[model samples]
Structures are given as C-alpha cells and as structure tokens.
Target: MRLVESRLTLTVSYALLALFAFIALFPIALLVLNSLKPAAQIVQNPLALPETIRWENFTNAWNHARFSTTFLNSFIITGTTIVLVCTTSSLTAYVIARRKIKSWKILTFYLLATTTAPIQLYIFPLYFGFAKLGLINNIFGVALIYTALYSPFAVMLLRTYFIAVPKELEEAAIVDGATHWQVFWRVMLPIVSPGILTVALIIGLNSWNEFLIAITFLQKQENVTAVIAFFLLSGQYSSDWGEIMAAALIIVIPVVALFVFMQKRFIEGMAGGSVKG
Candidate 1:
C-alpha cells in the first residue's frame, strides 16, 4: 500500500509541474504563432496558426527598427555595463569578504540599503546633473548609470563566492611574498570565476532589457538600444503586432541562447554562494 501511495504522489507532482510549465510557455507560444502571421490574421484569430507564414515580417521589422544600428548600440551599452560591473564589484566584494573592519560592515549595510531603495529617489538629481554635463545620449554615460544601479547587487552576490574561499590560501600567498594584488589575482579570482560569469550573464540580461533607464538616457535614434527600438515600433494610434512580436523574438533569442548554453555555470555559482561555510 505504501509503494502504491508513493507512486501516486510522484505522478501527481509530475502532473502539477507539467501544468505550470504549460502556463508559463503558453504566452511564448502565442507570441511565436502571431509573429509569423499578418496583422489582419492576428486580428481575426490570434490563436490560430498562419495559413501562409510571412517571413517578410522579420525583414520588415529589421529594416523599420533599424536593428542593425540599434543592436550595435545595445551591444556597446550592455558590454560596457558588464565589464564595469564585473571589474568594480569583484574588487568591492573581495574587500568586504576578507575585511573584518567595522567600516566595511557599515559599507556593506549601506550597499544593501541602496538595493532596497527606489531608483526614483536619486534619478532626478542624477539625471539633471548628467544633462548639465551633456552626458545624455552618451552610451558610455548610460553604461555608468547601469554600473551604479546594478553593481550593488553584483557585489552582494559575488561576496558569497569570495567568502567561500579558504582564508589560508590568501595567507599562504602572502607568505610566499605575493603582494595583495597578486594574491587576489592569482588565488581568489580563479576560484570565484564561476560567480563572475553568473554575474556577467545576469547583468548583461538586465542591461539589454532595461527599458526606463535606456529610453531616458538614450533618446537619439542612433543611440537607443534594441529595447528602445522595439518600443518605437508601437505608437498611441497604431501598432504592428506582428512586427512587434518579431522584434521581441529577435532581442530574446540571443539572450535565451546564452542562458541555455551557460545555465550550468549560472546555477552552480548561485547554488555555491548559498551554502554556508
């Protein structure tokens, strides 16, 4: 009887998980279905498969959105943000992880507090200051903003990896006549690299999909990211649903591919960080 009950429970759990998966994937299925249909067909029956697939929707969207240019702009911003976040946050995380100083504790708390704080709290003053300095529409400037906003979270995340490293390694490095920089570069960094890769993927995804900050800072047509370009496809009076979906898929495919390929590293880094030493 116990064996039968265990089998029943396992079956029920699988059924529930399958149901949840369908719920999550249904919208994405609809988006893919509609992306191949014309606007007229979408209006007629959104759920129905297209009788004739319109491959031209992608071409039209590519041209209309100026994806060639916008994609390059997004690459610059996202790549810049990733590099900045990783470099700075790794150093900050290392210091916080190793130091037992009171000031470091306070600094960690301050960064945590800022994570919970609303962006609007400082965006106005920051925006106005940047505008005064003529930093608006500058890709590098927008990257700086992303670095400030996202680095705190990255630091917090990376600290876990650093904390996991054995302190004896750093001491041994010092005893071997290695300087602090050498100790960090040779000993700590290699160990925490998985965590860094995870941080890079998460930060890159956020930077690519970030709408409000990107739209606000990158106003010029030539400077806007792919997300902004996708947004411009729609307007108050009208929208091209088919093309909009196509554009969304374009932006999503690469990110999804990256995640799928690197999912092991991402999961390992996150899981490793959560285990208590």
Candidate 2:
C-alpha cells in the first residue's frame, strides 16, 4: 500500500510539473516556430505550421538591428560590468566578513539598507549625476550602474560564503609567510569560487538583459542591443512578427542555454554554502 501510494504521488507530481512546463514553454516554442516562417505565411495562417523555413530572417535581423554593433557594445558593457562587480563585490565581502575594522559593520549595514529602498526614486538624481560625470550613454556608465545596483546582493552572498570558510585556513597561509594579498588570491578565493561563479552568472545575465537603464542612458541607437537595437523592431509599417520573434529568439536562447548548462553548479554552490554555514 505504501509503495502504491508513493507511485501515485510521484505520478501526480510529474503530471502537474509537465503541465506547467508545457504552459511556460509553449509561447517560446511558438515564437521559434513563427520565426521559422515568412511574414506572409504567418499572416495566411497565424497558427499554421511553417511551409518553408526562412533561415534568412536571422541574417536580416542581424543587419536590420545593427546587431553586430549592438552585440559588440553589449559585450563591452556586460563583460566590464561583470568584472567590476565581481572584483569590487568580492573585496567588499572580504572586508565585511574578515576584517573587524571600525565602521565596517556600519558601512555594510548602510549599504544593505539601501537595498530596502527603491531605485526608481533615485533615477532623476542619478541621471543628473551621470550627466555631470559625462558618463551617460557610455559602456563605463552602464558598468558603473550595474556594479552599484548588483553589488550589495553579491557582497551579501559572498560574505555568507566567506564566513562559512574556516579562518584557520587564512591563519595557515599567514604562517606560511604569505602576505594578505597572496592569502586572498591563492587560498580564500579558491574556497569561495563556486559562490563567486554563481554570482558572476547572475550579474552577467542581469547586465545582458537590462533594459531600463539602457533605455534611459543609451541615446545611440546603433550602440545597444536589448533596449535600443531590439526595440526598434516594433515601429510599424505593419508588424513584422516573424522578425521580432527571430530577434527575441536570438537574444533569449543563449541566455536560457547558459542558465541550463550552469544550473547544477549554481544549485550545488547554494547547497554547499548552506551546508557549510
């Protein structure tokens, strides 16, 4: 009876999960299918199967969106943002976790408290500040924004993971006559790498897909992907649904795949941090 109950419960859970999975994935699947059809084919039968694949749509989008330039700009911004966030956030976490210097706790609390507040309230001031600094519409400007926006959470996570690591490891490194920098680079960093990697992926994905700040700051239409390049597709002489879907698919698919590929590691990192803590 227990075996039968377990089997029945498993079956029910699987069925429900499958249903939800399909519900979530169906629209994305439809987008990809539509992207494969020509615009006229899409109109002739909105729900119809593709009569012929329109592989050129991707190429056309690549040109029409000025995607090459946009991608390069995005790459510069995302890569720089990730590097800055990881470096600064990790160092900040180390200070918060390990160093017992004056005002460190107060500073951390102050930073974390900022997260309880909303970014919307600060946008006006931030725009003027960025403008004064001549940072608006630049890759460095976006990187700065990403670092400030995401660093608090990253610092919190890293601090948790760092706290879980044994301090004796650092003591041993010191006994081995390694300097503080060496200890940080060679010993502490390796120990917290999984958490750092998870944080990096999260920050990278966020920076890659960020639209709001991009929309506000980026005036050069040819210089940004998600907001500037992608948004232009909607201006209508009749909607090019096929092209829109193609562009979206192009943007979304790789990020989805990256998450899928890295999800096990991400889960393991979170689990390991919890267990160690």
Clashes of each: 0, 0
Candidate 1: Cα lDDT at 124: 90
- Across 194-233, the per-residue lDDT of candidate 1 in tens digits comes to 8898899888988989988888888888898988988887
Candidate 2 RMSD computed on C-alpha atoms after optimal superposition onto the true structure: 2.9
lDDT by residue (tens digit), candidate 2, 194-252: 88898888788888989888888887776565545777765632277888778878888
**Model 2 vs. true fold: TM:** 0.90
lDDT of 1: 0.88
Q: Which stretches of candidate 2 lie over 4 Å from their true place?
A: 1-6, 235-238, 267-277
Worst 10 residues of 2 by lDDT: 268-277
Instruction: Give residue 138's error in model 1 in angstroms.
Output: 0.9
The residue pairs found clashing in candidate 2 are none
Residue 118 miss distance in model 2 (angstroms):
1.5
